[model samples]
Target: MPAYVGAVQVINVSSSGVFHIGDVIQIRPISNTKTFSGAGSFNTGDGLAIYNQYSATNTLDNDGIDQGINFNL
Candidate 1:
């Protein structure tokens, strides 16, 4: 599934069963690195003066789902 830039997706682990409407699921952002550059500041030689980087790790949340997910750059 494709999640939005700032949205979150939860995946539940189970052998076999029809999940109920409110059944709790186990999931977390194994890795989230969202970056952005400011348009307000720009240098003639360098480019944007301001930059932001966001990263998510297991420590950010404790959903217990290990093993990193693959992403295509």
Candidate 2:
């Protein structure tokens, strides 16, 4: 079966330090019921930015699904 692209939510952010450019990171879902379909990336040009480069083909069947990405910095 094809995987689904579930919903994404930002749970927290780093309070200290500044993120820089050319940074890559992988983020997993916060909820145990949900899973990340693929890897993700991050880029910080002048500010912190997160990108979900991986394409999700599947989705959660029920409610309370949480997904997120990380910063390489």
Candidate 3:
């Protein structure tokens, strides 16, 4: 069987510039584990958010966090 992959939410935090193909971006799941959604802004250490720092070129396939979500940018 194949591994189950959940839907991910992409967010933009870069300066005023168009996103490129290989541009790295932050992403997280839209679940109850975090007090966030695909809409609106958020702050660090909001809720039970699972923090992850991934590149758009690598996505969740690279190094990331699973304990809590917090962005310092």
Name every residue pair that clashes in candidate 3: 49-69, 51-68, 51-69
TM-score of candidate 2 on Cα atoms, chains taken together? 0.15
After aligning candidate 2 to the native by TM-score, how far in Å is the CA of 13 from where it should be?
A: 7.0
Best by lDDT: 2
Any idea what lDDT model 3 has? Answer: 0.42
| lDDT tens per residue, model 1, 9-45 | 6597454334433335553334444344354333466
lDDT of 3 by residue, 1-73 (tens): 3455576555974443344333355633332242423322334565655545642332343445555434423
Which ranges of candidate 2 are over 4 A from the true structure? 1-35, 39-56, 65-73
Q: lDDT per prediction?
A: 0.45, 0.47, 0.42
Top model by TM-score, which number? 1
